[model samples]
Target: MSRPAGPAPLLRRILQRGACAALVSGLLLVRQGRRDACSGAAPLNAISHWLWPESALRQCGLSARYTLVGAIIHWGASCFWSAIYEGHRQAGAPPPRARPPSRRPPAPASEVPSHDLVNALALSAIAAWVDLVLVPPRLSPGFERHLSDASLCRVYLAFGIGLAWGGARGRRAHRLPPGTRQLHVES
Candidate 1:
């Protein structure tokens, strides 16, 4: 099936991966927090613990204020990174070939570019650096407060994997299918 060639489809694809990346990374943060922190999801809640600075040091729960705010922040970052990745992929992608679909079935998620993982990982690494080193401590995700350096690396890795897996759900989107893209596209 031919997809409409325009900004609309492109935007949808980026959003799909963004939402997925946010979720995957957030979940891992929660899991790691539970394993290593005083409570569950503290790292996630710590993301927006600015209002309650002590939350990063001692508090750890699913409170709406901390968890909700943190989640939004994470989601926004994921989407932003996904957009950057999509744009880079678009710039480098070869023009579509004239031949019909090959005998081989579509790799799976036709909506997602075939070669994105490396780009996604590289982008995630940059994101991690910006978050940890450039962003002021108060504005940071607060993950480091609750996790070891090793665990922190895992969370970043999860973010990269999440960006890649976001579109892995299916290619039914764009044309509009019920999947991760549904979170980003109006179907």
Candidate 2:
């Protein structure tokens, strides 16, 4: 008789595809929004300044170059945190025993829930939005001419690319035998 495919593997594949889609779509939308915002004269320069206060430190304060650096830094940090969280989940291990006589209990399902890659990607996208739409604006010039929609879109795109890269790495790691299975001791 032919064997049935395991649900776990199927789920993993689905999750991976979802993650890729979310990362791409979220980024594109953010970029488009940024572009639309920057095309006007009373340019949202305040928003740009707010998103990148560090640019204010430059002698020629608020140049595109300096703002770009800030955007890159922001996106980079968001990607780093998402990857770190996903890595932790992927590499987590069950409790271990130190003695031959030890009787360990099986881990509860709640404690060993399957992680969905799509969820991770979605969260990463949310983080990117928070950084660009809320955090930067509140902390910086609050709506400068440079804070054009285009600039914000580029920032989101960078964040999305980072998230996609991390997700790909995580998917590969998930495919490894070590990452796919978990061990637990039972009494």
Candidate 3:
């Protein structure tokens, strides 16, 4: 299947990923707050404190200020990831080539899932792992140190779902119409 010839516009990528990130992060924040309340733990703003330790924010009485800043940072990071996805996608686009018709039988329609969504979700999950597991230790966010394994799992789950949704939306936007020019077409 042929895809569009170039990367999507920067604005489109930003809009897709930024919106998804906002929604995911907002939900996680509310969920975390509720969990903390039920367990009678301190109210924690995980996202802000991850990038800027809660201790430091509280020391300056700037937790609220930095929360907004952290959110901007988070949304920016999401857009960055979206841009990377587009780069990989453009690079992976098949070059034009002559090919023989397939002798093998086509798989039934029911057996085929949308590859774009499958690939997006898979890649998003990988990205989430890198972000939640690998990066935290390297940076050693003080706020993250207090989080239980379950909380971290929830964070990754939310991020993965958001990434998949945004990516699939972007991919659908760029898809070529059926019966559009294929590699076999000649002028």
**TM-score pick, better of 1 and 2:** 1
Q: Arrange candidates by TM-score, descending.
A: 1, 3, 2
lDDT (Cα, tens digit) per residue for candidate 3, span 1-187: 4434334355676568556855684467446645643311222333455555644334222255554555565666666666666566667878757679678864442231356446555665676666657785534322344446676566556655676667555555435455652444434
Return the top candidate by lDDT.
1
Q: What is the lDDT of residue 73 in candidate 3?
A: 56
Query: What RMSD does each model have against the real structure?
Result: 4.7, 12.8, 7.6
Off by over 4 Å in 2: 1-30, 33-35, 39-64, 87-116, 125-137, 140-165, 169-187
User: lDDT of model 3 at residue 38?
Assistant: 30
The lDDT values for all models are: 0.77, 0.44, 0.54
By how many angstroms RMSD does model 1 differ from the true structure? 4.7
lDDT for each residue of candidate 2 in 1-187, tens digit (9 for 90 to 100): 3224455544454345335433553354334435544422212223344444544332232345544444444334444455455455556745333557437753433231224444454555676565556764555323233445655545445444544554464355534555465643444
TM-score of 2: 0.36
lDDT: the better of candidates 1 and 2: 1
Q: Positional deviation of 92 in candidate 1, in angstroms? A: 1.4
